[model samples]
Target: MYGFEIEGGFTFYKFRDFDGSLSLSDDHLKWFWEKMGKAGQISVVFYDGSVESFEDFKKLAKLKDQHFFLGFKDGRPAGMFWLNGFTQRSCFVHLTIIPDFHGKAALQMGRGVLRHLLSVTDVSGSYILDCVKGLIPVMNSLACRMAQRSGFEKAGVIQKAVYLAAEDKSVDAAIFCAVRNNEVKVSE
Candidate 1:
């Protein structure tokens, strides 16, 4: 089990049985992709208007700028959390929770991951996440709401920020962000 105490002395735990293991190794890359594909959920859309295949996803995950983690629940693949375009100031967070673990469980796991990111990593600026408005409900809406509950606030909307293959068009995205210091206001 892994754990950390966030602000206010609240401790969060990522158990091997409940929250599963999180790792950046290639050993679980394929397994993670398989689980994501099976969920019929596409967490990200490339700029080229193509959804990444398992191979391409693995390659992208292996990139130096990206941090990928696969979570296993009860010794099986359960969820994934990724940080793309990481820099000293900020990064984009992408999360996917298999349908089987959707709802409250997914929200708990997501909060745990976000708390870990904020408290454990060297990321002291901000953490941002974008989600296509239309897909929010179907694609883990609870997790999106949990972000706000965890101190992230809605920043703004980006028109045509993502290409949805299923719809064959670009869609508006809702941007949310959490800043490390309360003094730094999110720009309008």
Candidate 2:
């Protein structure tokens, strides 16, 4: 894992701040919110098409779950990503790689993060990833593909669930579940 390298000749450093409150500051929070608007890696649309304040980000970060932030070589806040429902059984994520590092070494950091999430986090059964059908770029990342390569199948699509973002706009989303439990598989 230490020998892994990314496209821009940069190596990934694991940020252990799972609580998401360590490196964050007023300025950094503001930066995350501002950057969210132009972040191409994110598919979910924001209420105002802009993340102009850190309050919203802080709230999101406050969720009691496992989170990870990937940093670049120069350490200039390349990207911010995290996961929810992180438990010994399974975990989920709302990831974004930030636009600037879309095709650079920062992407490697994102992949590494996902790999860590899968390897370290004990998904009691197997790691499950939920993604929207329209967000192909995200679903096609190395992490998701790796899960498929590992024999994780498309369990099913989440049919019911209306996500209400800011402004009370309910959004429709699809969910994908993967179970790596041999016992469950054999039972089925």
Candidate 3:
């Protein structure tokens, strides 16, 4: 409700407070695809090992139950995320702090943005969500650690859950969760 929604954005979910938003015009979409296809970025997020074309990236971006947002700080892009499998109360999240901001303020931003997300309310004046989940590749220890620092708890692991394109194989995924009144503990 605080952020200005533009022509190419998810108006309901935009947040200016934490400086994260989704504005998906064609040109901006192209920028997202190009940035996400970077060697470091692609390895963690894409199962195809690459986004071969803008079309492919577009399809993924517009996939059912998936919403993407770019994080910003001082008007500069800082990170990005995919919110997947969104239901009335739960969703799966994949987040990445840009390489430049890595190890700098990952924990602070992650916790703040996530807590704010949990506090978002729908037009009906009800809390929109109660939980957010992270399904991370087991090999990505850094991500796992960051999730913990962001107040997520290790829930479990799913076998052969994530297919890494670069690895050309399926890898186990570690599940992490932050519940609104529990782990996340959002307050007024």
Output the number of the TM-score-best candidate: 3
lDDT of 3 by residue, 1-188 (tens): 34422221212222222333334455655655566666357656665465656787777766555676666664445666667787779988877776656663666667766776677787898888899998888898888888888778889999998888876888998999888877563221
* All candidates: TM-score: 0.66, 0.55, 0.78
Query: Lowest summed-lDDT stretch of 10 residues in model 1?
Result: 129-138
Measured by TM-score, how close is model 1 to the native structure? 0.66
Q: Quick one: ranking by lDDT, best first?
A: 3, 1, 2
| Residue pairs that clash (backbone atoms under 3 angstroms), model 1 | none
List the candidate 1 regions with Cα displacement exceeding 4 Å: 1-27, 43-49, 121-143, 149-151, 183-188
lDDT of 1 by residue, 144-185 (tens): 465565445777667776566666777776677765545222
**How much does candidate 3 score in TM-score?**
0.78
lDDT of 2: 0.44
Residue-by-residue lDDT tens digits, candidate 2, 79-132 = 555555645556555455555665534445544544444444224754443221
Pairs in clash, predicted candidate 2: 88-124, 89-123, 89-124
lDDT of 1: 0.55
